[model samples]
Target: MSDSKHRHKSVLKKTDEELLTDDLTHQLALHTRQGHNKFLSESIIPLMLCFACPFFVRSIVFICDHCHGSIHEFLQRLLFDHTLTLKDVLENFFFFKWHWPSAIIIIGFLIYAIIMTMLLPGDEYQGPITDTGHIPIYRNNGFCYYIVSLIIFTILTVVLKLNNLSPTYIYDQWDAFLSTVSTFAFLLCFCVMIKGKYMPSTNDHRSSSNWLTDFYRGVELYPRIFNIDVKLITNCRYGMLSWALLSVIFCMKTFELYGYTDSALITCILTLVYLTKFFWWESGYMKTIDIIVDRAGFYLCWGCLVWVSGIYTLPCYFLVTHPKQLGFQLTILILTLGLLSIYINYDCDRQKIQVRSTHGKCLIWGKPAKIIRAKYRLLNGKESESILLASGYWVLSRHFHYIPELALAFLWTCPCGFQYILPYFYVIILFILLMHRAHRDDQRCRLKYGDAWIKYCDLTPWKVWPKIY
Candidate 1:
């Protein structure tokens, strides 16, 4: 106990950055101790809390009512209201009547996700279904459910607000709750439905003439035009679309909460516009818009969009709708930060691409030279060589691009405010996810590049960012 207390005191005395680093180390240590099952255990508690909190509060209210004039008054009447228990105090404000349907849905989804995570193979596979000869299964299911749920939830929320129903009524805005549950459901399903085992590895060295032609041309022209290559474009579009849609929903709900002019229409239009841009630009214009993105692009884009927009924009929309609930200055600050981050990230990517295209070879400090060659095997057993330009941005940091990427994520999520535990959840999750991805990429490189990778790592030690990370 004494040792533990001393350690706690030492941690408390550290600078904020040091403390945060320590916390991260502690979290990673815990994961190491617990193994991969740590994810399951970490998630189980939150899932339970989401369902259990409402029930726990309801039970307390029920018991309080039996002996009291009013639960609040009774609590106040006893031991001085100031001395009320933390549970009683929380029950007073964030109380909600338990809804069996929502609870069951949440629990069911949680269970399904756990099963899928445990049972599914880790190997990548082609999706079972295709749209226009493209691998569209993940996005199709995720987006379809997201759109359907948003429509249903919006309609229900409008009806409830018009009827002057209490916000605490579970059915009032049940769609938001349900959509949350369903998103997890699909994510779980995606994990379980791995088809990648049958699919060829990206690293396989083969000729492009036969198999590449078939794989690329098997899809219809329209889909093929959208750059739906299995090796490059993964299932990130679905995640991005889902997050953008969810943001609109949150914005609409915020407008409703504030009794302001209905902005749902505007929000919907913006969402559609972004989705269209994403499909058009991300799908086909990768080389035009920016370069260097590969399979990782899909995950990076979607992860940032969904996690940040979902957590930050949604709650802020509610607060905006109910301005009394949140301060105006803080809201503006968050929005500004998001805009800044986005601009920086986009500009950085553009500069990198433009420099590479214009120079033909990457230039570092006016010196032009090649560091390494990338060997790609086509589907038909032919080998091709592409130079890996390690000079320009690549020389600065191993993964310089990730710096702006993470910054953008932080900016998008910062607007969610510091008032609730839920808002900060995305930040925590993203940090861990990105770190794990970096580690995986490192392992892949170690296997593929052998000695060359060691040299590259030595030259550019930083993985995601410079110095700090």
Candidate 2:
């Protein structure tokens, strides 16, 4: 092969050590190996391209269709010729055309969730100790809010269809959803910037004091609005519930366009079951890294608002047009495998929680929960105990949970079929996300646990996949 081709291949095959470095540009460059053939096949690249790549695709196609152009010219057209002007952005902001319905949707859902949270009876559960040496007591009412959201979604879908209007109105209001979600993000960031008086003591660390980064990372550790937990509402209600709601809309749209198929039903059922499982384990979720460890910054807030509700449901959206008629037997097989994966994933988590809660007095696979008492230091440099599990699914691999979770994601989208690559976008992105998350978690434990973490690793003998990574 030519030297240039050899160099390109070498660049693509950068050492895992290089990828593990804290270099954003280098990571971005490596991810570019996943070029424009398809989205889902590219692994982690789809997460970024899902926003920018597809939007420019239509314009690129239009330009190519109208004018003959070489590959270089096409790429140049994609970058230089397709810039979004301020006027177009402003026009999308207005509620005149397609924006009004989605704007109403934004307001209606926000008010309903907020009001439901206020009216619903809630208890308090103190979270893990914060970096600033405080355990935050969060109001726990996500279950009730989950029920209310289901009711609202069902009512709206029925009411709209009964009035000869389409229940899948959201599919046509993509622009509206974008504009409103952006508006929410803008207002919330602004509000967070000005909420100095409301800042939690847990957020005393300003890191570098860079306003842009801090704002993006968030100023408050846990910001509440008038006695309501903002994180629960934004992350759980808005992001998670909106995910389910959008899936429902996509299901309706598919039925409207093409009669119900096993593929569509499977997609809808997997989505609904997964989301319902989320609420069923709402309290268990509160203890997760997103709620306890991560900041409520743009990465989390805007991500949940925009990315989670929109791109997360791409499989269902793709299935709307490319409906797969996977026969009944295939559908059942896919679902059975998917549910088994979900159960394994859930059981892994349950085992860990049980070990921690019972102080290693729990059973794993009909035997005692094998655990090592790992001593760790908190952000405040104080000592704490972390029960490092060595039993159950964890005994198979350090991150065996993620393996099955990825499987669950794949099986969930199997109905989308293999004809087009778009439907498996979630599966690819999720695997990459989980792998990255696992690495982060590993680094975090290494720092916090020090020698204890090293010992735990020695005992476990894996980071994610055993004997591979």
Which one wins on lDDT?
A: 2
Clashes of 1: 13
Candidate 1, residues 87-193, lDDT tens digits: the string is: 75455424433446655644653343334323433333333111112333122232233345456556866787789953334324443343443344334323222
In Å, residue 194's CA in model 2 sits off its true spot by 3.8
lDDT of 1 at 54: 38
lDDT of each: 0.41, 0.67
lDDT of 2 by residue, 255-287 (tens): 888887778888788887777778767777777
Q: How far is candidate 1 from the true structure (C-alpha RMSD, Å)?
A: 14.9
Assess every candidate by TM-score.
0.47, 0.78
Give per-residue lDDT, candidate 2, residue 11: 56
Whole-structure CA lDDT of model 1:
0.41
Q: Supply the global lDDT for candidate 2.
A: 0.67
